[model samples]
Target: MTARVLLVTSEAVPLVKTGGLADVITALAQALRQQGVDATVMMPGYPAAIENACNLKQAGNLPELPGGPGTILHGVMPGSDVPVVLLKTERFDQRTANPYVDENGAEFDDNALCFGSLAHAAVSICAGETDLPVPHVVHANDWHAGLVPALLRMKGITGVGTLLTIHNLAFQGNFAMSAAADLAIPDSMLTPDQFEFWGKMSFLKAGILYADRISTVSRSYANEILTPRFGHGFDGLLGARREALVAIPNGVDTGAWDPASDRLTVRHFSLNDMRGKSGCKRDLQQLFGLPVDPFAPVLAIGSRITHQKMADVAIDALPGVLERFPRAQLIVLGRGDHAYEQAFLGMAERFPGRVAIHIGYDERRAHALHAGADMLLHGTRFEPFGLTPLYSMRYGTIPIASRVGGMIDSIVDAGLQGTIPDDASGILFDGEQAQDMVAAISRAFELYARPNEWHLMQRNAMSADFSWSGPAEQYIGVYREIAPVEAQALFDERSAAVNDSVNLPADEEAAEAAAMPEYMTA
Candidate 1:
């Protein structure tokens, strides 16, 4: 039988969004439902999200959240079939405008407690202690919902299974142990290796160790995380659970992200009626105030300005890029660190119409940029299955990216593979060097100069599929494997293994360890 799944994540579409996590959650949830799987998405209601997407209707109150009680509000957002549950904490969550942010634009310290509360609420629903609907599987995304699997196992919820997915391991919520009492988590869970990493409580580790099954976003990333270099220091923990871990790549929403039907794009065009795309290019150039050079190559970028995205590569290579192609232009969007902001703004000043930088996110502009640009640049230092490149592909823009992680799996390298075919989708550089980026850009420009070759690449990109249907089906398969009948035995086996590994000889040591901050190095 198809299982009823509870999709848990810190962010969801039509609500709180900072990255690809939101897109993954909403797309997968709806896709699962369409395939006859019953799924509900639970997300925190940030002000922006509530204003933009929430259609609120009462789904009853949750009186037993950790630290105190909470009122559970429910609703449906645009483009999702899953029900959204919002947890409003009287002392913590209610005061904040965003789930992950405070007034100072800093990440709230109470993230552990906030998400732990989300897990606790799921447990309550699982135990039939509340009137909310019980899902057969609790699917937790990233570190935010990491505690769900552990909490469910601790409570011995008989019929519910937990599946923890790691979207990005880098942001594992490592919070202070002083707030342990307020978190209301059991004392037995504290340790140097389980929930404790050094002296900090790692929410990611907890999910990895305790969940019935663990999954990463991409197949290559799953292999990547098993080593010291990519594991983010949790390789040993993940190594132990290798048998339980699965790697399933994410997919994009074809309709929403596609240039063919996207309302946000300045001009819509498909593979057949390709002439309109040139119009889109002209419109986008005019909008961004770049020189209207129809022959000049346009490299579009819409990403957070951070090391993870390799903004440094773009900054360092600007001079060489300008030297190589005098007419080529670069359009950048999104915001992050101050260093990247200053670098891009400085370049725009130095190179006027050739380089345009938009300080923050503008979804409408992003759509137009994707449709209009000749190439999409994604030189990420390290990425966990970036969605922008996939969007660019659907928009018929060739992608030039660093060949690492998901980029390796997605984009084909023209250098190693030799001359790109008429049906080539993109070019992948093998390293982080600016020379590598410049060389790749040079090849792209060469192709751009030849309209015939460039159109072939565009057709190749447009022919590629980015639909969420495939990934959703794979996720449903994972959920079915952990249905109630299989979940009980899995939970018991997991509990015994953990208990064996972390055998506590005395109650005093456990109590002291629990009381001491988890992040404190021994």
Candidate 2:
């Protein structure tokens, strides 16, 4: 009686990953299975995914798409038992490099055709055109899979509910209206009420219009998108479907992110004994070629270098921070926005050993930074749901973040009155100016001078739970709301049993955590 769900996404961790979306899809699917739901992941067969898959077998051939027929391959996700379906076609097979962009950082020219075929195949499978079981719900993530819901409705496929999750509204999949014929979208469905957005065909708009439900990554983000400031021109459309919109904050894989067991770090440590953190600090300083001064506060940046991420603000605030704390060092790791990249490189050059910059991403280095650094610097203008801050907090590294997006939901600012009775995880500052970040850094330095208070804050951060159990329960509730009566009863019974087995703290901390945000807790 369990409702079957097909998680349609463009990327998934271990197989392919471009951002946090990959991690969310993989972890959420696994969490759903633990909650007694039958979940499967469906994605295009990029070269990396095909190469990494084990026990792969040909499932069947899909119905003719705009480009040609696609062959479906079945395999299990590398580290888990979750089943995965890989759509194999000429277009997807040709994408040997990055899934969405080319070496030059430009989106592939045939992106519309590439993703359109994925959606068409999803609809065909759900409509009984394939040999696979029909999913009770088709859960699509981001613009890459946005066309699934629209195609489902256009084909008049019944009994299949669609849930579209908007990870970031800024990257809407927009293409010229003339490409509709190439994408095989019917002309009748091209009105402003459907896929049309300001005379252009918007794949994201189609999903928002046709999906049975829509979700954002965080509660504050869900509310922010309803206004003109954060909607990116889709505010009015999303406002019309306000009732269907919900927020399910992203969660961290505690097992994979635990500081006690993480193999990526040089030394393992926990709240019980933080001596290993000093060893990790020395290792990080050695790795980055900075002075191995354990007392010098290490501030790390592990986010993409982009304007929205406020990488410029982080860079601009460094000089003032260095002037105040002469021994402070900064280590930056991530790649994006050539301008920001050059700016960071320039900073590293200007301040020989104190500043270190890595132009690209390395999973091991990121984990090391989170475990080794004293504080994580995140100055984002707008973020849907950032996973790095959560990861950092779990490692007992305090976050110095801007007061926006998921940062507001996740980090409990020490300065915020009445937020927590005796604990604070991080520091928060408002505005997008460099001066704002400098002030926040100044406050962080002042707190760092008091080891007792700083260690107490670290304990609070390490004790915080950002696991998937709560988010999985929330998602199950959404599924039950759209599922049949029999399925609803089955879900309710399973959920009750699951909730009973979970042991949450029975003190004021639990109550305060629960009251923080709807998406942060059950």
Candidate 3:
């Protein structure tokens, strides 16, 4: 029988997005539904997330929320077979654009409470406490919905297993324990085995401790999180669940990401018709205001400018890279840490015409940049599963990335090893040092200097299958394996309570961040 899965995420496609998490949620939900694995996507009504809502239904109402009484808003996904729910609170109003924000462009302190409530609503749906159907399983994505696994268990609901997918371990949400009551979770549940983290309430820990099974975005990431280096202070906790941890590398929706079919790119090309790719290079150059020279190697980046992304390595190697390859040009997209922003802006100013910077997220520009660039830059400190590298490969762009997490998994196409195989995608830098990056880029540069060699690498990248079908199937296996008849009644009861909650929309912030597409960043 098909597993009825309730997928909970902070963001999803066509509604809102700020990173690969949303894409993963959208892809998995759609793919599962296609496979007859019934699925629904529950997301916060963050302003950007609700912008595309075609219609809404009052799911039900909740008596008291963290801020006050709240209402539940439900809407169906545009083209997919998934239902999305938005939690609106009477006191604070639900966020309309940014899920994590207030009027002054700052994150709300009640973010934990806000998102926690949304998770409760999903659980309520599963327990049949709401008007919606009781799901066989609740699939929680990332740290945002980490509270789901624990909240369901806290309500004494069982049988409907909770599968928590950790996209990135570095983002665990740890807040004051005082918020536990607001979350409708008892202080006793905050013990070391539960949601506690050194006297703080940890949402991520809640998932780790309570979920029936734990999964990460990549196998390497799942293994990495067991060590002190990648565990983010939760290695011990993860060690406890050593037997329960699983790795399912994320996959892209091939149809949406295909270079041959994507109209956003300047040139439409496949492995056989690569000549059109040069047009993309010219388009990229033109868009970035750089010299449109087919001979120059265009190095591109489309990620948040943060230390986590190892963007500093790119900044540090800029002078050397420019001196070594005079024809080299860089175009960066996305926003992040203030320090990195200042540094990138300074570099752009210092090297006019050679460096182009777009400070915020723009999905179309990101797609164009991925298609047009000759080589992609992904020097991250650590990655759960870097989706951009896969996106680049799909567009026939060779990648130069750090050997970590999903970057390693996605960049290295299986069975093509050593001696620049015809299917060799890109160069891998092992260390975080600037010299290492400079050397790797230098190697890519050497390859770029040779037209035939560069074309072979591009072909290698394009042939990879980063599609969601396989991963979706894997998720289905995990969902079914963990689902049992025992949890059915509990799930139904919880669903009803959640459906009975309130949802209030947040007022438009006067100083909201630029309303560019939020999906393609980070």
Model 2 regions more than 4 Å off: 416-421, 484-486, 493-522
Worst 10 residues of 1 by lDDT: 494-503
Off by over 4 Å in 1: 52-55, 91-98, 102-105, 416-418, 486-522
Q: Itemize residue pairs with steric clashes in candidate 2.
A: none
* 215-269: candidate 3 lDDT, tens digit per residue: 8887667766766777889988887787787778788888788888886887798
Clashing pairs in 1: 199-518, 199-519, 199-520, 200-518, 200-519
Q: Ten-residue segment with the worst summed lDDT in candidate 2?
A: 496-505
Model 1 lDDT per residue over 1-522, tens place: 445788888888767777788888888888777777767888765555456555776555677677677666677776555777766665444634446766545887667777888777777777766556778888998898888888777777758778898888888988887666667765667787668877888788889988988888776677667657678898788878977887778888886887678888777888888877888889889888998888778888888888888888889986678876888888988888887899999999999879888887767788888888989888886677878888888878889887666776776555533467655778877667788788888888887777777778878778877676767766766666676775433222312221111122468445744653222212
Candidate 3 overall lDDT versus native: 0.77
Number of clashing residue pairs, candidate 2: 0
lDDT of 1 at 72: 63
lDDT of each residue in 1-522, candidate 2, tens digit only: 567889999999888887888889999999999878889999999888989977889877875786777988888999898888899888998888678888778999888988988898888779877777888888999998999988887778867878899999998999889879987788988987778998889999999998888988887777667657778999898877877888888899887899898988889899898889998889888888899998999999998899989988887888878877888999999988888899999999888889999988777888889988999988887788889889999888899997767778888888733333366889988888889888888777788878877888899999988999888888777776665455566554544322211122458435644554432222
Q: Which ten residues in a row have the lowest lDDT in candidate 3?
A: 495-504
lDDT of each candidate versus the true structure: 0.76, 0.84, 0.77
For each candidate, give its TM-score against the true structure.
0.89, 0.92, 0.89
Rank by lDDT (best first):
2, 3, 1
Clashes of each: 5, 0, 40
